[model samples]
Target: MVNNRSLVIIALLAVLAWLASTSLYVVNETQRAIKLRFGEVVETDIAPGLHAKWPLINTVHTFDARVQTLENGQSRFLTAGRNALIVDSFLKWRVVDPNRFYQATRGSTDRAEALISPRVEQSLRNAFGSRDVNTIISEDRDDMLADSMASLDTAMRDEIGVEILDIRLKRVELPEQVTQAVYQRMSTERHAEARQYRAQGQEQSERIRAHADRQREIALANARKEADRLRGEGDGEAANIYANAYKQEPEFARFYRSMQAYRKSFEGNNDILVIGPKSDFFRYLEHPAGGASK
Candidate 1:
């Protein structure tokens, strides 16, 4: 009878332990939970820490409150200029209202993503549609993303129970055909610009060279003019000296000139001359006493 009583106590203790295990639940700081009784939500916002409910009657469903990422795969969009771009983007989100989240998406992250993704895609489409390719590719991209994020956050929170923390574009690319066309156009423009620069440089160079040549010609002409003036002045001075010599001593001047002519005519020992003996060239030679007639 004592042994039976001990077994009954042991079984009761075991049952109590099982009930305790099923009755208590824990919510971590990174998680938010909902309590449901008979498939009906009883509590939506169960704070962190231990909570109690009737064993086998109440159940808690917990979701990660931490940030989660959703990657929207590559999709094509058209810019304001009708240029096509392949864009890859991602989202950062978290559940803010567990009750509404469960109601809207049945507490499924996949369903939440499904509902949020279309809105994000639509926002991207609108942004890309209103902006040009250059604006989308340049620093204005940040502003575009911010605008999209703000709009998406507002709409998502209202329609779904998730708040978007961030939206990021991973990659943006032009289609292969567009890329080739753009490259060719850019190359052509660069070549035209280079040709224009070369032409301007050539024109400037020609102007400089022409100016230099003109200056050189002017310098040479001025130098020649100065040289001719100096030569004429020297000739005039020599003529004046000769005139003074002739006025002071006419006979001596004649004799000196005759001697100079003779010296020049017989400058070399092999010099030959054909002249009449009584010609004027021999007058001074024949008259040694300075008695030649003028």
Candidate 2:
């Protein structure tokens, strides 16, 4: 009888331990729990620490109340110009209403991804598709992001039960063909600009050289003209001096002129003189010292 009582007591203790283990739950600081009995939510627990529940009949579903990140796959889209592009995006979200999250999504973060990813992709396409290629790639990117954020927030609130903390695009890229074409166009533009700068430089250099040449020619011509004018004036002044000298003494002038002519005519080595007695060359030549003027 004592052995049977001891065996019964051990069985009871094991059953109590099992029940106690099933009924108790510890909620972490980052988690919120919902108690569901028979597929209907019976209570929602927001505070952290230990809690009690009926064993086997009640189920506690825990949700991460902390912020979460969801990164989207690469999505292909087109701009207004019919150029195709790829966009990579991500979202920051948190569980605001655990009851709503549990009811609509059963606290399955994966299910939330399934619902949010499509909406994010759709929002990206809708915002980017209406924009031109320049706007998509340029300073208007911020506006595009804002539009995407607004649209995504609205879509998430209506379609899913989570709040989106933020939405961002990781990358935007042109399609392969479009990228190649843009690169080609950019190269051509740079080449054209370089050629234009070179041509302009050549034109400027030619103008400078031509202007210098023209200035040099003008200066040389002016110097030649001034030199010729000064030479003519010098000759006129010399002639006037000679006339004054001749007017003062005719005989002396004739004698001086004869001496100058002799000096000029006898300058070289070879000499030939053909003159009669009456010629001007013989005026200074006397036949002999006594018979010269007789």
Candidate 3:
């Protein structure tokens, strides 16, 4: 009998433990929760820490209140100039009103993203449609994103209980065919410029070569003129010396002249002279003083 009583007490304790578990719930700082009765939401925004409810009658659902991200999506958009671009992007969002969020998404992150994505995409499309590729990619990019959120943020807040924080574009590029066409045009322009530069360089080089040739001709002409002047001066000085020698000693000059004539007249082995020996050409040979015969 005592064993049966002890078994009953243990079974009661087990039942109490089960009741304790179902009666209490917790909501931490990073969580947002809703209490439901019979699968219908009865309360929302439950405070953090432990709270009590009727066992097996009340249930709670919790969601992360922290910011969420939707990433790695690509969309095609057109520019004001009708240029097409493939944009890779991501979005930041979070639930702001738990009651309204529960109504809208039924506490499903997937559903929330599904509803938010198209609106964000449409906003970006509008923003991109108003601007050119240069403006969208350059200094006005942030402003364009801000403008995109003008209506999107309002719609998300009012209907979906979500806040659209930011939209970041990872990459923007042209389609493959457009890219190829642009590359070909740029290459043609570069080759033409290179040809122009080469022609200009050759022209300048030819001008420099012609100028150098002209200077060389002038230098050679000046050298030849100076050399001729010096040669004429040397010949004139030699003639003056010869004349002075004759002036100083006329007979000595006559004797020297006769010796020179004799050496030239017999320089060859075969010789014949038809002139008279009494001619003035033999004065030196005849008198040894180059004087006229006595």
Predicted structure with the largest lDDT when compared to the true one: 1
What's the lDDT for all of these models? 0.90, 0.82, 0.88
TM-score of 2: 0.71
lDDT value for model 1: 0.90
Candidate 2 lDDT over 1-294, as tens digits, reads 999999999999999999889989889999878888988988875578998989878989999888889999688898888888888878898776677788778889999888888887877788888888888777556566786787677667666557888877788888777798989999999999999999999999999999999999999999999999999999999999999999998667877787788788888789876767666554655532222243
Candidate 3 C-alpha error for residue 19, in Å: 2.6
The superposed Cα distance between candidate 2 and the true structure at residue 237, in angstroms, equals 12
Give the lDDT ranking, best first. 1, 3, 2
- TM match of model 3 to true structure: 0.69
At residue 43, candidate 3 shows an lDDT of 88
**What C-alpha RMSD separates each model from the true structure?**
3.7, 5.3, 5.3
The CA-based lDDT of model 2 is what? Answer: 0.82
Higher-scoring candidate on TM-score, 1 or 3:
1
Choose 1 or 3, whichever is better by lDDT. 1
Off by over 4 Å in 3: 1-4, 37-43, 140-144, 149-151, 207-294
Tens digits of per-residue lDDT for model 3 on 205-294?
A: 999999999999999999999999999999999989999999999999988888999999989888987888888888788899566865
Lowest summed lDDT across 10 adjacent residues in model 2 is found at 285-294
Residues 114-164, candidate 1, lDDT per residue (tens digit)? 999999899999989998988877765668889889988988888777899
Better by lDDT, candidate 2 or 1: 1
